[model samples]
Target: MGLARRIAGAVFLLLLLALGLAAWGRFRAPSAAERDALELLRVDSTPLPAKNAWHALWLLDYIIPAGEREAAYAQDLAQLRDRAVAVRAGTPVPPFRKWAENHYAALPKLTDDDRAAICRPVSQCLAQVRTHPEATRLALTRHADRLAAIAGLAGMDYLWNDMPPVTAAPGPDIGDVQALWLTAAASDFVEGRQQEGLAQACTSALTMRRLHVGGNDALGSMITARWAIEAGGLAMDMLAQMPDDAPVPAICAAAFAPPVDADVDFCEVSRAQWRGSFGSVENFPVVEHGAGGASWLLSRDQTRRLAAPAFVAACKADVRAAELADAHLDDAIQPRPTPDFIDRIGNVQGVDLAVAGVPNFVPYLRRNRDYAATLRMFGTALWLRTLKGDYRTLAARVAARPASVNPPGSRPIKAGPDGISLVMDLYAPVDGERVTTVPLPVPAS
Candidate 1:
């Protein structure tokens, strides 16, 4: 009986001790690794969310910028929710939907073969989209004042506070957004407004670039870089449409000459991923909203801690990957994928998809470098076109900008037997590298 009593008391004491340790672990200060991650993730606090291009984009639902300037975005959501509910319940289709169905039924704008022929390859479509009898360009121009306003704010910061993943939309086909700007630019050039035309072209690219630059999770940065480099393709096509004697402004060349990571820092983007993306998962009862994982806690923190090594490693990896932005694809260094693991303590904290945001940053880093290289080629080609005073001048001028003309062995200007086109060895993580050509519409003066 005495032995049984002692065993009972001992078990009770151990239980008490375990509970104390659990509670302490849950609330303990962040560790050295945690602090370093937090420091890297910290962001500037000034930009007003109202001015964010993210909110201003109508395709993203014209969010906070919808109602009267002072009206709450909640009002817009309430109206939209009620409308969506009504539609789902079999109410008559909204006029906008009818109109959209007429011109752009499914995404990729598969209105018909005619529309596709006119706008499928954005490089080919920028000049002709305006000519569609149904006022095809209106698909973009309908949001004219708003588009212009958003473009004007491109250089400003976009601050997206914590938002749940369930409510968040990954955003529309932003490639269409770039096409919109390039079309407007082509229109300006045709009207003999060269200065204003190129300025609009640069601004539109900048706007699309800013749309995703520091805003969304890892996917957001990739979208921005992907589309921005795409803008270079369309812009080159638009430039081809310009008359040979057309002057290339210094601003137009300067705007595109820098690296992709110039204005937005990829490391800071990971910080934001933690703040907002984790909030997406935190909506689940199992997660906490703080910036870092508390080691050994049987909660989301410890589960997400598995992502820490990858997130921290990204800062260094980005620098290394970017160094090879201009090198050949075979020469680009691949950062090893960091695996998520549970050291001796973990039992069964399930992995959250949101936790993968930082762990999966390697692809985004590679895309950034590729975009930088592609942009360099685009800028270098633009520079040569501006300098090409007469026939066979491209080679000499391309050689002059050694720093900008990467992988110089291969001539970017493909003056084929029939015509001349500016080309870049565009790199994609999946398809490897392919020569992307933008045919110049100008006569070789």
Candidate 2:
């Protein structure tokens, strides 16, 4: 053969070999045992992507420098801890300002007085929330600026695509700063600072709502809304503890607006978001077996084609289960079965439902909405108590406001055996009758 003909023959042979390997890679499925082992991939509970950038920014400023004397702000924390211990011993406590000092001095942009002004209200607000008898010392008007600052920091929206990829495990866990505003709101309400308390509560609620946003990563975005729901639940629990006749402030009423839709649309939106995030990452995890004991490692995609379909189908089912549960809430007598079938997809050889990080989010997203729905019910119950002296009058008042008394996701509120506290559950009594009970602790006479 001539030189050009020989070269063409070699090229054709290489093309044939490439095609054969591609075909095998596509057709070969993992063994049953390997499928079982793949479930281990689901255990990767790394921190949410937001933790990365937030932590880096926080440490650069608030972290104490090496070899420096502890700042006065640091001393304030120590003093507060000591004071908290003393309060337990029945020691007389001073006014809010005495036990703490402003500590936002670490920020370079604010001047000394500006920092002091900022820190002072935060300190006092925290003290009020901590249940100081002298909470009346600070005017509610003083904390307006501080609450604004806290709201600003809580974040208006969470942008998932902007999140830098997780290069390594995240740094120290930051306490949820938004909780402080919540505590302040609860304290103000109890102290008769209704307007201010409602403002603080509203700020916290709106801040939580801000976490809902659009992005490529569906699980991460929903995680933000889910967090808002959990936080809002805490706020509702606080309101429930108030007197039945306590006038509901307008801001509190507004804050009580549902943080997210509690219908089929929510479930559909969450599943679609997860779909966008599916397989978007370069480093998909894997399991390896040989002479050595089996282990898991994060490698770029090598066998995703063999595993992804079952994983995605499982994810869809899990999301659909939540939707189905919501759709039937109006008539449900028992709690809907939370789907965990995805987690046990291949149990025969011990590998259950296995998936990469993106799909692993389905379980978390599913549970979060449930918790959110329960919080919404708690708020509704509080609203009911505010209008009537109790929640049991719903049947008589249904015509006054049709569909006004939907329980949390069709699950009724069950008062504790003592008939004082409320919980979100449906225990025995399978007759499908509408169950009703007061969720709040009965106020003292």
Each model's C-alpha lDDT? Answer: 0.51, 0.41
TM-scores of the candidates are 0.65, 0.49
Predict model 2's lDDT versus the native.
0.41
lDDT of 2 by residue, 108-199 (tens): 33334333322133313334444553433242234444344445545433333323233222322224344434555656666777656656
Give lDDT tens digits, candidate 1, residues 48-112. Answer: 55565443342332322334422433343444555545643447644322112233222233234
TM-score for candidate 2: 0.49
Positional deviation of 306 in candidate 1, in angstroms?
Answer: 3.2
Best by TM-score: 1
Give me the candidate number with maximum lDDT. Answer: 1
